[model samples]
Target: MSTRSEALLARPAAQLEVRQRITVLLTPPGLWLLLFFVIPLGVMALFSFRAASFGAQRQVFTLEHYQRFLADTSAQRLLWRSLLIALETSLICVVLAFPLAYFLSFRAGPSRLMLLTILVIPSWTSFLLRILAWKVLLGSSGIFNSLLLSLGWIEEAAPILLFSRGAVIITLVYIWVPFVALPIFAGLERINRHLLEAAEDLGSRPWQIFLEVILPLSLPGVLAGFLSVFIPTVGEYVTPLLVGGVDGIMYGNLVQDQFARALNWPLGSVMSLVMMLVVLVLTFGLGRGVKVTDLAGV
Candidate 1:
């Protein structure tokens, strides 16, 4: 046989080996997702359609839960409120994180690792503890109120500081900023330094270079970080529970109340599915506008 024919014949064996390797690598994670995520989601969907009864002799499926949710103005308001708060939180995190990320990416130099470690250290603490810390800080006699009192800024502790929608947004922004910064930092790091140098050589000012080059390139990371914060915050119940009080109640709170307090699993499932669908839609919509693959330098 000719050399080309021998190589072509061997190519099938090589291709089979590669395929086997890929299957071996993907099998564990694929099975894990099937067992945990897909199965649970399917169960939830099934429950959503079923009548809200645990020990009924007959099983009936209906769309009344969804119908009720759609008709409930209060529930719809809460859903909109939750989405707005999540959007606000994501925007605030992006605003605050961008500066820190920029500094770390371009200015940290030898102290980059140390600064990044410091930035992430607080996140290593328990999530509940962090929320509780914010609770204390915003409380009547907390450090914030005390500082305001000592500084003669207020006659008394501000009741608006804790147990409100603002409190929920503030706490969530604080919690998510570190995580948001990491992606922006990664995106910034991936930018070709030569681009900036070339811009400088072309007489572009610092602000011009940032606006023209850096901002455009780093958008993917910004979007990724925004989605990261926005999606979870929309479904957040714990932070609002601890710090938001009655005023800060979100859509997720309604779901929790149905499942835990009201024993209405079907309604909760319906709400859960609706929230998931909304998030998926928003994510897909945004994905269409800005490709997240750019964040990975793909």
Candidate 2:
């Protein structure tokens, strides 16, 4: 072959090699998504349209589940409550997490890693166990009540603490705060310190610097934390089951009951699909408001 012909052949071969390498890199995740996420979601979507159990004599394709969810006042209330709690949890997490994230990112100069480790260590523990521990702590004779009693803060052990809506919110906050804080801390870390210095040099107060420079810069992290906490907390079943009592029951509990106790697979699938749709809508809506260019300054 001529030199030019040889070069042309080599170029094609290199391109082909690159294509094959890219394919190899993508294959595992692609297969994983197809098998675990896409396929399962598709199956659930199919199930949502059917009115049937796992094994039944007769089956019918219907919108009964969706209709029931829409028409039923109880279901509506449950869903509303779930969303309200999730929103509350996300907001509270943001408020609580911002201070911690700020400290971890800027103030925890030497022991930052240690503090972060302490924050993360609890997440490694069994989720159920954490909820249960909270249950114990808020119980009548639990450490919290004991301390209060010793301090002469209350006349009797507070029965209202253990199995109340407040307890549910508290536990949800406790569980989700770390998730929210970590993202905010990451956002704070990515912030250019020079910006804050410039603000200070320009005679900006501490709060002013934070409001203008820090808060704006760290918004991406706050959004991430909000999404992380809000999405899962909406369908939270376990925590409410453990500590929420009757008043804390959420849509997730109904979904769980439908699947596990009632054996109403179709109904459960509908609930799951509805929750998924809400999550997708909210995510897209929130994401649309955030400009990618805004983070470029970081």
Candidate 3:
């Protein structure tokens, strides 16, 4: 036993050396996140418990902010609305992105890079500009109304499209389309053609192939895209402010107002924490629900 133990102990130190090297490499990013992400979150959490006076000053630590949200029915309703909108946006993006991604991966062939260039080109312009452009295209006196009027299809301009819930969805969809497409496209592109071909050779119909192969493989990308859109959209403030009105304003706008205008940082910080926790729970739950790893590359 001793001889065997010594033999094992006497093995090359290459594994330990490699591990040490890896540790050295990972330390920088670890420290960077510890300083930036963890530290800032800690600070925000500390502030979240503090009491806000009538004039924006925070006093000693208190549970007022946290309790206030729990007790406020309107705030709870607004939170639900924010979550629903985010989910809606994510669902829409995922539904639209899947086919486009499949096309880019399977049909576009070597031209994908070029297609991707055009697809993502809309991002070069400012997001606000994009929303404004949608306003011009959809508003009462916008181009669509003008076109319909020119054709004598309408007696008057369409209802003012600005400052509506639909408009907000349209603008946000435009802003985030690229985000959904890129990940799904990359996922589909990583699929092995042979697997698909083999499935087809076995007399699987197109729909069957897609159901049994393509979709199952693309689950990871779908989840990733969902996360990308849903998380941010849950906290969406700008789209609601620019394109939506009182009815369209989300929980994020309220949170922003709490901090910026109302000068209620304690509530804002608490709200932010609650929103983050909600997002984390939903992300993990969705990942588990979808079995995200199998389609990780897809």
- For all predictions, the C-alpha RMSD in Å is 3.9, 4.8, 5.5
TM-score of 3: 0.85
The candidate, 1 or 2, that scores higher on TM-score is 1
Give lDDT per model, in order: 0.90, 0.86, 0.82
**Lowest lDDT block of 10, candidate 2:** 289-298
Ranking by TM-score: 1, 2, 3
Tell me the lDDT of candidate 3: 0.82
Off by over 4 Å in 3: 1-28, 53-59, 148-160, 289-298
Name the best candidate (by lDDT). 1
Q: Any runs in candidate 1 off by more than 4 Å, and if so which?
A: 1-11, 289-298
The per-residue C-alpha lDDT of model 2 at residue 254 equals 95
**Candidate with better lDDT, 1 vs 3:** 1
Backbone clashes for every candidate come to 0, 0, 1
Compose the digit string of candidate 1's lDDT tens values, residues 1-298.
Answer: 5776556557988668767878999999999999999999999999998886486711788998999889988988899999999999999999999999999999999898799889999999999999999999999999999999999999989978999999999999999998888888888988999999999999999999999999999988888888878989999999999999999999999999999999899989999999999999998888665555543423
lDDT-sorted candidate list, best first: 1, 2, 3
lDDT of each residue in 172-249, candidate 2, tens digit only: 999989888887888888888999999999999999999999998888888888888898899999999999898778
